[model samples]
Target: MRPTVLLFDIDGTLVTTGGAGRRSMEAAFEKLHGRRDACDSFPMSGMTDRAIVRKAMHIIGVEDSAAAIDAVIDAYVAHLAEEVHKVDDQRYLVFPGMREAVKEARSRSGFAVGLGTGNVREGARVKLERVSIYDQFDFGGFGCDNEDRTELIRCGAKAGAAKLGVPVEECRVVVIGDTPKDVHAAQGVGAECIGVGTGTFSVQALLDAGATVAFPDFSHPQALEILLGGR
Candidate 1:
């Protein structure tokens, strides 16, 4: 088997936190900016927390400075952890076959799993721990890694390659996600993208966004083959 690294996305791809993330983010903005709906119109798919904060600040007519953005990130992480615990059990959903996919990947040879998510580090941990699948990913690139989604994905791929004892250029890197942004980001870095429609977007939407492949969920009969075959 060739050296292969799979970078997975949290939230919509691996698990769904319902609106817990939004609520938490909103609370943070309200506390930091006195604007309860600062991020209401922000597009969140495949975006980094840093980007989100910056966008939200712009929308709310606040100064978008490095200092302000960092503050928002820090506050959002704290609020997100608190809100995750308060989320209803039913609201925290793990997509069907995703856990199986993750387990299967871990069991397979030449495969290293890591995260490429828009969420901040602590927020990612809390969200996954809420769904009890946090242990599957030991390393990842969070929104804090960079404001650019593509860069964050590359960061994850590099880290994954490091864990696999190979350079990223020598490995077949694939990004598995649930939104068009994921596909677009993969395209930016010339990597393969498998778009799952477990999020707000549909399969067609992802395909339109230039995903090489799109699926409704990981429960398809040939899901395992399709997922692993990206390499």
Candidate 2:
């Protein structure tokens, strides 16, 4: 059956942010929390924004409450804005065959596209727009909404289902991402996950994480077809 919802991960899946996201997070901590030592070495690949922030706070012995989280996010936004201004060349690039994959998925009957990513709402928009693919996603779940990756996938699925006026349970959700976290999130919701080894993780790692299918990269048309086919 054709998937009713195609949930995509932003960084490392649709577009590559290089080290911009990590730099932004570090800048936020330094500027807002008055701690340059915070997040000196935190694993960012495939982790949610909230998870990253919470871990960074723990490392600095700071408590992460709702208010503190908001402040950090605000700081992150500010830092991202400032950094984006300084960079004359665009660093974010759309993954090869990503646009064609999105288009093909959308062309399929009963298919809809949305994002489930670790990026905050504004950050997600900024990155997607930087790559000129912001309009492809109809809706999304942001990192600010929740700390859990599974919850984010659920939120994205719900939003897509709502947009199509279908029941969430009836939606055939297919999650496309480049991390084990994404595979786990899709498994949490009993949805199909397609793992692309374009990120830090390898294809074997994704398979071990329980992805329905894994690819070295989506640059191949056959891989893209299999992924969009919900295999």
Candidate 3:
């Protein structure tokens, strides 16, 4: 059966942010909170931006406030621009076969593509546009709205179902991502999870997380074909 909606994670799934996210968080701490090492060793993989910022603030013993959060976000955006500029030949890379996969999925009838990521809406757009795939997604769930990854997946699934004029139960939702969190989120919503071992996690690790299928990478044409067919 054709999936009614395909929900994808941004980092480590479709593209690499070229370490922009880490640099941006570090800069945000330094510029807005007067802390230089707030994000020195924070584990950001598969985490929401809001969660990252909140954790950083907690580590620095700062009281959370809306104004402070907004300031940090602003600093992160500015820092992202600067960091992206300095990486001369090391810009973000769209994963191999991603273009073809997206093209084929989007071209199919009853198939709608959307994002289920830990990035905020604007950040998601920035990352996707950098890799020239922003236009492929019809809608997305943003980390700025909620820190829970499962909730974001639900939000994404709902949005995609809305776009397709289908009930959430009737929609064949597939979540494609790179981490255990992604698998957990997909399972939380009763969606199929496709884990790609393009990030820190190994294929076995993702399989342990209950991914429906785990692949080391989808760069191979045959693997890509199998993945597409399975979806």
Candidate 4:
């Protein structure tokens, strides 16, 4: 088997933050700009924290710049740290079999596991640590890396490959995520996506979005095969 690096998305794939992320974002925006509902109108699923801040800023007639967006994200992470404690493994659902699947991938000779998530790195850490899955991932491509989903995925894959001592171009990268944007992101870099319908979209919707395979949840019987690109 060729060396494959797998990157999992955080929010809806590995574990649901159960609104802690949203509440944190809302709180941050309110504190920073005095706009209590700054993030209310944006389409958030699969979007990066920087993307969210940019969009929200645009909606509120604020200038969108690297420095300004960065400030918001910095604030967002701080607020997230506070709000994340509200979510625990008992309250947040870890998709069935995900932990074991990641373990299985780690044990395989030609595989490496990491994260490619839209959450900012710190926010992702907070959310995953609460769910007890943070230790499983050592490197990640995060919203802090890039606001663009496609670029972030590539960034993540490269990082994962580097950590495994493999060349990025030679690595067969598979992104496991739960949104159409995740599938589209993989397409942007010519990688395959294993889409799980643990988010807003259904399985068929994920397939329609160009995922190599789509499963209703991580519990699906052929999940391992699908994750490994065997199907």
Which lDDT values do the candidates have, in the order given? 0.85, 0.82, 0.83, 0.87
Per-residue lDDT of candidate 3, residues 27-66 (tens digit): 7898777897887766789998888888889899997787
Q: Output the number of the lDDT-best candidate.
A: 4
Q: Write the per-residue lDDT of candidate 4 for residues 1-231, one digit (tens) a residue.
A: 767889899888998877888888888788888886988987688999888888899889888988888888888888888777776657687888899899888888778789999998888888888878899987888988888999999999999888778898889999999999999999998888999999889999999999998888878889997776676
lDDT of 2 at 83: 64
**What TM-score does candidate 1 get on C-alpha atoms?**
0.95
- For model 2, give the RMSD to the true fold: 1.8
lDDT of 2 by residue, 132-198 (tens): 7889888987786778999988899999888778898987888999998999999999889988888
User: Which stretches of candidate 3 lie above 4 Å from their native place?
Assistant: 221-223, 226-231
State residue 102's C-alpha deviation in candidate 3, in Å: 0.8
- Candidate 1 lDDT over residue span 1-231, tens digit each: 668788889878988887888887898899898998898885687778888888888898999999988888788878888888776778788998899999999998888988988887888888898888888996887888888889998898899899999998988888999887789788877788888999989999988998878888989767678778742
Better of 3 and 4 by TM-score: 4
Between the candidate structures 1 and 4, which one is better when assessed by lDDT? 4
